[model samples]
Target: MRKKWITTSLIAMFVLTFFAPLEARALADESGKVTFTKGLDMEGVKISVYHQSAPLAKENVKSLCFLDSYFLETGYCVTTGFEVGYNGSENSRFVSLTENYHLPIDLPATGYIWLETTTEDIFVEYTVSDYLYTRDVVYMDVFVPGQSVTVFGIGMSDASSLQLGEKIIDGKNIISRSSNQITFKVPSDAKPGGRVFQLVNPISNAIPVYVSPVVFNDPYQPSQWYLAQQQIYEAYDVFAGESEMVVAVVDDGIYLNHEDLSSKIWLNEDEIQGNGLDDDKNGFVDDIFGWNFLHGNKDLEVKGAHGTMVAGIIAAEKNNEKGIAGIADNVKLMPLIVCDTMGCDAASVANAIKYAVDNGADVINVSLGTSGVTAYSEVYNEVIKYANDHNVPVVAAAGNGDVNGGIGFDLGQFKQSPVCNETKSSDVIGVGALAWLVSLPAWANYGSCVDVYALGEHVVSTTVPIYDLEGGLYTAADGSSFSAPIATGVISLIKSAYPNISNAALHKYLTASSIEGILIAEDAFMLIKEQYTSADDFVAGEVSAVDVDIQAIFSDVPGDHKNVQAIIYLQQNGVINGYPDGTFKPENYVNRAELLKILVGGKGIFPDAAMYNNCFPDVKNDWYAPYVCYAKKEGWVGGYPDGTFKPDKTINKVEALKMLLNSQSVQLPGFVDVAPFEDVATTDWFASYAAKAKELGILEETGYFLNPGEEMKRASISENLYRLLTL
Candidate 1:
């Protein structure tokens, strides 16, 4: 990419040659001299140009003569783009125009130019428009370690009189209009990355502030996506799909009209549009295409939809020309808007469930849930049963409130009114949040109903429609609210690949097919579309179709047994362990860098590690530094800050993945995706090694040359080692 240069003098020469007649007027009116005025200043250089007629104002003429001369000398000129301007009372016949220039446009500062002009004469002014630009806008200037700053800026507004203002850095309001800039110092007690600005305008109802386009080195790089490519890659490749699954997000609603998620939306082909009649006639009226359980109508508004984020989680169009990609790129998303202005009622939620079940939803995603007793008991029982009966699996979030032995029983006893006097439904498949690094968020609910977990930190997703915007895309969110959609996407992947699997069977398979140890056998098979006469009919004895090789998983020792006794014990109790192979090979050296992935696969925990990028001297893109990052964050492992994690050195297998899964009440499987190698055999001391790998669908046959006896090279084992942890 060679830089192109255009000199003003060259353009001037061309313009003079082409438009010689126009410059003839500059010869003067009566005094035989045309006054050349300085309009603006560049650095210390002032620009002077003779006033020319209208035809000479064209770009071709300006570029060749006036612009060419000015630009060649000072590298500045009248930008051929839209500009913002205003008129002042002092100059009754004068209008002031401001030239808008994009940032990093070879300018010394960030400000717009204002030109003054009258009917018969034009002159450039040195005035600049009152626009605010800040370094914080380009870079996420997180409050320094132990600091928490709250930056404020203008939001969307429609009022004419309203103007954006600023506040003091120390939480005080700016009294004078002259003071429009301020910084809020972070309090020592405030936690970093949790605070965001709340911009409000007193005059307008609301205002949508255009995001400033400035690139700055992210202070929180260790926590951003680019730096955690391994975790992203792990989650990406595990349940790879051909982009055809339909994940029905039944939430508040969705921006079904959004460009990214719209293409994959499932439209009810059988229904008619706006005919005021139930063309398909499936009980509800005008569900002609996707029902709205909240208003109980077909026409749904974008503002109230909670399902849009969930839709983004499943398939919000991939690496297309716009916005973010979903977990499953090519999938159909059927949005069932079940919430209104007051939020979703239990009855509405249940109705949404029934609608999704009745429709052809491969996977129904329910990002909302209730832990306390609900007034609508029928909605819960009936909808739960309907979803199961119709073979549509429901992936719901475990409520955000703590729900250990059940709601209101964290200390092992029913201590609150809700639990003491009421009962909650147990049929819904509940999911809880497992942090991006490790350890469960204290606020994340826990209960017997909680069936599984997934990444749920700064998890980005879709937002409802923002009207009249050129390219629709918005990112800023968190919660189990996001986790549920991710799980739903995983379900969609499974269903899309094996569509014939019964909803109940598929549900069982998900729990059954999970990475392992992270969930109980029954937990794995429990909520996925299950078939039973009643809740009580789901007894413990019937062996689930998705089976795990219990003994073979525990027998092998990859390293010293005492080191990772906790992980071993979990495996024995069916908490976690390797695949069905007999080789546990604990003594085999583990790559230090791939630890984050190991935790993801071995413990079901995502990581926030500095990516082992391509440019690093000793680290490659596939190195284990990323895994080590998650390990470091979650108290799983440590590395030299000097930028190295000796990954090839043998790690105590037990001490390896357990550091993350332990101390945290999360559950995952012992399924590492290590394919069988020539020297890495089941009988070679690593019992259950091959079986676990095979069970996890991540192995190659023994004859495939896995030279375990040879020292793993930085290049040879880096990528696969990371995948082994993630898979």
Candidate 2:
């Protein structure tokens, strides 16, 4: 779409001709004449006028902004939207006051009329007002209680004192205050809502910051229902992963300066930027924010949003008061550009794969695919194989067909379709798209080749100027291209938690984690509402309901494993483990102390050991002291009447189930109206646990026998953990 040019001068002339007399009073007060920065001397430029009310323009209009599209540079004018100094009988509405790069308007208050030639430079001073001061924070992200958050805004340099309104957080402990941002922490008990921060000395501006009493908030996150459908919230509750792990996004060039993506971009510490020489001597010069393969240089020259959207889905910042919270975080995104204005070059795609693998990417995400034609490039096939050979898993999108009513194709019927066919291996996960209703789209490629599914349509993500045209912020998108990244983010979460995990192991986790069947939109909405209301944070329901087989990861366990999928799930997430000799020993009876260990580990709770030393008489200095004492302190366990924990005793079925449900955060019903087993009544001590387990199908006790005192074995524990973790 072409940029629209506004006839500002003509409109001003026409309005002046009709509304005003022949004589007009153009302001001759010329103390602050701003010379247009020499580089931006384009005549007859259009300016978007958004008038703000008196006293101050706030952060919404800071720092005069210029939107630079091809040949058209639109600058923002925050004013009265009327001609200046025209006091002629209140006739004219607007006039063309601008002439020869100089326009002066009276000061409504104290501020500056800053302008940018390009991205930066030039200022117009408006002096200061003795009666009222004008200052505001540029922007602030959602603040978590007891965590440091930065409040950035314009004109904070003169603030001598600061105060928070309504007693949300303490205004005393400021880490530091720059001209742009102030760093501080919110009180642990601050309630969620709008918070007013006043810069005092003489009081400038009181800006409202989004204060989240809970941990997470993103304006568009509720629209991001894919996170709910994919069980990403539950995965994050277990592990958010680490920043050391990297996922290389190979696609069209990304908007490096995107607000949501800038901080998460992977930096090449070895190379210096823009010196025109290869400081690292690896191959490319000035490869600071990963390589821009389009021109084989550091200049990203991002002309599209495909790459930015894909990368955002993989690693956009979470809980930021931005557009949307991306799936994965605490992981770096290596932008490996392989596409341009025309399209992606096959050879460039191959080179990007090699570069990503060599530079230590944990996984490679390719959203590009042969949409319509049955075109198979041997070069892409070789690179995919090369990536797998190096143990760098590759995830690609199954084709979204073509522009002519993109019909889904079963690539399994053919030998090679770069999107799906070449990606059926253990190291290559071919992804298909799911609609908002959790139903597969008719145009989404699905067959023996498409390995898994993720929400594709209406996926809200960070965007660039090309896609949005509004530029920056976010937009909802469709197609299988997006599904691949959501899957890639899940892989990123696992890889970040366990950097040493094998790609083949990740393949099993990824495949087994997904479930089929429809979850009607209304049911999902109601379930999510209850979870959010009752739970302290976001919770994701189970993804797949299919019973998955666990491979023999231990010497004692057979390849055709007998138990549910949780053993590998737990092991993969760094929750449970086997003996040093590689034996799982499934029959081993879980001791009281052992049960505490498993429960605590499953919850991903790691309290400081220093705080729990010698917590119990019999648990002093024991290996299980931390877990046992922490559990005891949380009221999940109690000591014997003799005041001894009796840590060595075997755990019974009732006790194990209670601990499992509590530690895993399974919500207890308000009232246990009916007992699950004939032997157990509503008044029984373990009735709630038993009922919850029965409702969730955690136990296979169809006969309704309450074997309350039976010893809980390692295998039974694994099965219980699986149901709780997965379900």
Stretches > 4 Å off in candidate 2: 1-215, 370-374, 403-405, 415-417, 421-424, 517-727
Q: CA lDDT of each candidate?
A: 0.41, 0.60
Candidate 1 residue spans exceeding 4 A from truth: 1-243, 369-378, 402-427, 465-472, 503-509, 512-727
Q: For model 2, how does the per-residue alpha-carbon lDDT over 231-270 read when each residue is reduced to its tens digit?
A: 5555555644454668898887778878888888888888
- lDDT score of model 1? 0.41
- Total backbone clashes of model 1? 71
List CA RMSD, all candidates: 25.8, 20.7
In terms of TM-score, how similar is model 1 to the real structure? 0.40
Model 1 Cα lDDT, one tens digit per residue, 140-199 = 222332232222222212212322222112323222221222333333333222233333
